[model samples]
Target: MTQSSSEEEEDKVEEDKVEEEKGEVEEEAEEKEHEEVEEEAEEKEDEEVDEAEEEEDEAEEEEDVVEEEAEEEDEEVDEAEEEEDKAEEEEDKAEEEDDRE
Candidate 1:
């Protein structure tokens, strides 16, 4: 009976060791899963930032194009005014010559 009790004790110790090893493996797997979740979240955040930057870039480009168009319109108005002034000058000169004649 004494020898049987010793054998049972040894068997119980082995069982405890196997349970501890299994627990360690499960804990390691859980840790890996947590790390994977964190990495995915970070990647998603980075992608959102990139998209925001792209939107800002596009907005700036559109503003530049609008400014260029406004400048072109102003230039066209100036040219038209110059042409009208030249036409008025020519009419005045022709009237003065007719009065002199």
Candidate 2:
């Protein structure tokens, strides 16, 4: 009868150890899953920042092109005004010569 009682106590101790080991394994798996989720969130944020920067660069390039075109148009208008003034001066000189004759 004493031997039987000793065997029962040993079995109880083995069962407790097995339960503790299972709890530790479950905790480790939860921690690994949480870390992976955090890493994925960070990667998504980085991608958004890169896309914003690209859009700003494209807008700046478009503004530069518009300014260059405006400058070219202004130059053309100035040349046309100068040619009209020269024509008026020649017409006035011919009228003065006919009056002297």
lDDT value for model 2: 0.90
Model 1 over residues 69-88: C-alpha lDDT tens digits?
99999999999999999999
User: Among these predicted structures, which one has the highest TM-score?
Assistant: 1
What would the TM-score be for candidate 1 when compared with the true structure? 0.86
- The parts of candidate 2 lying over 4 Å away from their true place are 1-8, 92-101
* Candidate number of the best lDDT: 1
Off by over 4 Å in 1: none
Count of backbone clashes, every candidate in sequence: 0, 0
